[model samples]
Target: MDFNFIGTIWSLLPPVVAIALALKTKEVYSSLFIGIVLGAILFCLSMGTGFDGFLSHLLNDTVGEGDDAKSYGLIHCLSDPWNVGILVFLVVLGSIVSLMNKAGGSAAFGRWAAKHIKSKIGAQVATIILGILIFIDDYFNCLTVGSVMRPITVRYGVTKEKLAYLIDSTAAPVCIISPISSWAAAVSGFVSGGENGLALFCQAIPFNFYAFFTIIFMLMIVVTGFDFKAMSKYDERLKEWYERNGWQLDEVSDTKLQIVEHGVGAKADSKKPKETKGAVADLVVPIIMLIVFCMTGMVYSGGYFDATSANYHDFVDSFAASNASVGLVIGSLTALILTIMMFVVKKTLKFDDAMSCLIKGFEAMVPAVLILTLAWTLKSMTDSLGAAEYVSGVVASSAAGLQMLLPAIVFIVAACLAFATGTSWGTFGILIPICIAVFPVAAPLRIISISACMAGAVCGDHISPISDTTIMASAGAECKHVHHVSSQLPYALTVAGVSFLTFVVAGLTQGMGLMASAAISWISGIILLIVALTILKRIKCKKE
Candidate 1:
């Protein structure tokens, strides 16, 4: 009965099935569940086990006491400390957002922004600036930027899909490039072979084409008002829907927008935001406090406060050692408590109303939480099926013979694996070690290849429907998850194509050393992006 399918071509079936079904049906929850089930079934077949084995793989009680005896099931995924921490952070963050909305902090900020930012472009620029500034963590960036900028973007007729796209593009791209961010930590921790992981990560930053180019492309689209066909079609539909309803484009409120975003439901009505005494500080202060507390929590988690710890008192080292999930949970909870206290003390919200946000916040995030749980379970299923091992083995086997074209190859492979797995750090773990093993520690090509791994992982994570960051972006914008994925695909793919070409140039020119290869690669990337954008603009013009 043994199928011998684990770590083979068949290992990819579950994710491929899930992704295809989700994209086709536009039903994320069911699609992910089916994938998880398929993975468990496959595992059972491979191991020559029966229904009992399938059930164990599906939702087991086995404790992962050691690496050899590790269990990957829906229950185990949910029970993992890191997973629990993330879920806790999401609930706290959702509550904080609810409290802000009920206290009128969001409304106040929107009104304030309305006077200062008079155009759609201005609003988008502000959003980009805010996103760039919050580079400590992508999850925090996604939710915080969406909560703060949603009102202004809505006022300016920014479609919820577009808002989600903006939130998503900025979240991981900015995080991947920031030295003090969680992504840097993840990448640094993945390196081996007698090299300084952090130092190598810093070296790889310049060659992370997708991260930089995605930012560049976002700015271009924002500045030029150019939209690809998919996004443009959505824009037209939004305009027509607004016009049919006899609402002025600029006057559309966030509440009515939500109705258009996800159908007419009582959920939209109940979540209709109310403005308290309009004070910008009501929004600004809470956000500032969140950032401060979160940063402090990250450092503390890294043992910055412990005298006996190696990372003690060193900001960068502490950040590199920080546990993002734990830090985010701690920071978000403290911020939530303070925000509720501030609102109640100021009479902006009654204590009872403030307490009510607990349920409201959890309610708001239920959809995201459900999607995330399913996604996590699906990932667990893939793990049980040896998806990572399969991908790593493939990369390791093929990499030695593909030196000059290796960076581009790595980028594409990493992108595909990450896209299927819906986890960038997992992709990093699989590809980075292979890259390290293929080239000498100080080889310039090694650095470029490593950068490609980081870039491709972020790129795939950026566009993947099941990625938590993507889900967070959808939640943050309060957009339909499917809509966000569809609208952002063309845009993300455009950048990915350009990034792929840039990695090719880097690989071809590695003989010139890191600086020369990087310079050539960046210059070529910019030219290619400009050419691509120009072509897209012309197509838009012709369509118009």
Candidate 2:
């Protein structure tokens, strides 16, 4: 836990090990635990002791002692309020989704959307729009978008890998650019003093090339119906599977069956109730409630309701100060209760059936929740290793002569750190403070540089197989985790390449006005992305 003396190259070993193993072995849990153990060993070695000291660090520090001590490991991480809240929300949302599936809400919406969306393009485009609207949090966006759209997409013959990519692309990228987002809250918290953090964040949105260009790239792919690199091969395989196995969803499921409603001509049993009340409005109303309640909860948590609090009218300030984990839990719980009542009152589900959904939903989310818990604990280990301090020291020491290229350099380093650690929040926490310190308070380049940090963090997390958002995206899409990662890598990298170049342009144009510079850089980046993707499309065409 005491990281002062151990902030060395050894500090980065855990995440590096975890990432490398995930790549080589295609497993996440054991790799993460190994990294945690390695970090604990590093803690011991830094104490200038042997195996006995290593055991103590692993047992007492990583796993924790009795109760009173300020422990800094897995036990401490799980007990933390933020982690607990998000875990609870995941379970609750899972139950709600299960209920929707059971009540025939999902199937009914699928039937409804089937009438309107006639092509693959419509399916993909609609998924993107839905992803953009759910801008509160990436986890919610990933799962909800996947669950709600999965039926429609399958109906239209969209591949699970492609669906996963769409879900992943929209979740983080949309949140990074949206002002009223948890990503915004995390970014603004990095800025010190009485600075209008939200204002600066909004200003940087235009310069967030990775986030914006990822969206552009995604839309172009969906519109054009193209795939290249590893994605191309996977896309072909999926087509073959659909052709050979028919339109059943089982080929994509990993042992566990997807939750589907009781229906169809020959498949429907006489005992099943009619799905009269479960219309598209059933899905629409609950999602609307969740979004509204989430916003209300966030503001309330930020003391917007406190008459004594100054800046209560300033919604941006309240949003910047709100506790996202607590707010999301509150919002999700309210939405769940409302949804249950609505279902029961409409006679879509009996009280006993709705109650059973609680357990079913928890079962569905166990994998995601387990992975998130591990990811959070992994973050705790990285913090205990002082990954932030080490990154900060390096950035501070190197800032003097590289002013023009510093933003690009910071972007790359942040990307690598996030890719290794699989966490954008942790990466931004480590890098954003360093950017703020290196440049003047009011400097346009300072804001540009910070934006680069966030954009790059999102970009890396987008590609990382171990990233929690990526994991959730895979789960939501009901795709193989490895398949999702492989298919999404090329798309993420293409955007990241354009984003890095944009940072270079932004750095060069720092003397220019912020808005003008952002405009120029964004235009250039979008052009580059389109060009690069077109080339890939051409290659795929030639191969075909």
Candidate 3:
């Protein structure tokens, strides 16, 4: 028999095993590798191949010498041009960050912020605002916001867990809703069948309940001083430690510095100079230049600057066709070169000192790079096993009988898929096409359902322990990965629950005009979220 697990229930095992083991063991690398091996084994069994087949599926790529030829596995993922570009961008960005720190730009900014930002609330709010302002890409937002706000937040006694949550809450949520972002470009690329993808994405933004509500929920958390029990425990521990040590609120002690610098890839004690002639401009100029060059690179890659290319178009159109990986690599490399020159020229760092940051930066990003590589490989495993096919088939089968409840159902399915695979872009690639296939172009429910897909994907990505964004946020804030995941879950779920209900309302009211339906559902979502938070706060108060 020609055996295969393609589009079957068994295809889900690899990612399921990966997610389950990661959550239980709290060890990502081995868990992901194990899942990859299992998936390869499954593929071998399905193909009726022997040990060689397993080896090929695990570490090698196939070029189709026969009918059974396929392309997947870890080696293939590492060799992929897109993945390499992302890796390059990460390394370059890491070098830039290290240079900034070595030149004392970060410390200067920290001192500047501490002097001006008076309260804990102000620091937290500033973090959120900065996160929101960097809406071009989530990866960029996570690292930038973390580096910029970490010192200020620490100075105010905000827990690392809390800072990670703030960075994460704004990252994907903001990008998913912003029309000028890399996320919009990704989403637009999926709109097939002669549809205007960018326009559709804009129309759907108003209905992205999860993304919008998450931002609101974060602000509410900051304003109301509300913390979920998991997060509160972290807060309480920090408070007790401070009390025990008699540490002043504003003091940046060596002990605290060690805590902030721990496990996030950098050794703060060795690399940073005691004194340097660095100012806020050293930090601010590079970041601003990075943004400018990155945006230009994205548009250029999309052919906006290439009049001879067939894809040549205006800024938005070009960006829609742009390659994020390529653009980021190009932009970050340019920014790194410029930043090095700036630091060296200003005498903040010697040429040799600036050059040394490249190594330090690479070292700092090793943890993130390893996690990302494994995550990508794990995703490759699921691809080999046909997990996306299985999920899509299931969704297609279930769509026939449930019209009004469809949006909510889609949201749940998308969330589960993203949570399992730990890839929001992959989730979008899977579900958004299915959504377009299920509903007519003119159908009111089409927009709502598409919005649900995006919301659900972001929701899952936000909470998934293995998600790259989650990993980046932890790395950015210098928090333990497990601590960030465990602390952020309750808050993400709270918003997710409200989002699900909102999707239900949106699905039911699809007969109404788009504006009316969005307004009604949005208002209902706000009320429900506020009520849920109030009740939860009371419960927390009672527990205290």
The global Cα lDDT (0 to 1) of model 2 is 0.80
TM-score of each: 0.95, 0.91, 0.95
In model 2, how large is the Cα lDDT of residue 231?
73
| Local lDDT at 460 for model 1 | 92
Q: Give the TM-score of candidate 2.
A: 0.91
lDDT of 3 by residue, 178-257 (tens): 98888999999998878778999999999999999999999998999999988988887777766666666667554455
Off by over 4 Å in 3: 1-4, 63-70, 251-273
Could you give candidate 2's per-residue lDDT for residues 1-544 as a string of tens digits?
3543367767778888877787678787787788878877777666666787666555446433568344666766678898888888889888889888888788788777867887878989999999999998998899999989988876666778889999999999999999998889888887777787788889888888889888888898888877766776765665575555445533322111132221111232335344456777778888888888888788777777876767464576778888888889889999999999999998988999999999999998887777776766666676667776787688778888889888888888888878867889888878887887788887988888888899889988998766889989988987877778877887888888888998999899888888878888878888888789888878777877
Candidate 2 clashes between residue pairs 3 or more apart in a chain or in different chains:
none
Candidates 2 and 3 compared by lDDT, better number: 3
Residue 240 in candidate 1, Cα distance off native in Å:
1.2
Ranking by lDDT: 3, 1, 2
| Local distance difference test values of all predictions, in order | 0.87, 0.80, 0.87
Q: Which 10 successive residues of model 2 have the least lDDT summed?
A: 254-263
* lDDT, candidate 1, 1-544, per-residue tens: 3487788888889989998999899999899999989998888888888898889889973534677687788888889999999999999988988888787788778877888988889988999899999998888999999999987887777877888999998999999988888888788778766666778888989999999999999999999999877787777776776677777866667677556545422244757654457478878888898899998888888888898855575778778778888888889889989988888788888999989999999999999999999998899888878888988888787887888889999999999988999999999998998888888876888899999999999999998999999999999988889989988999999999999999989999999998999999999999999999999888778877
The CA lDDT at 142 in model 1 is 91
Clashing pairs in 1: none
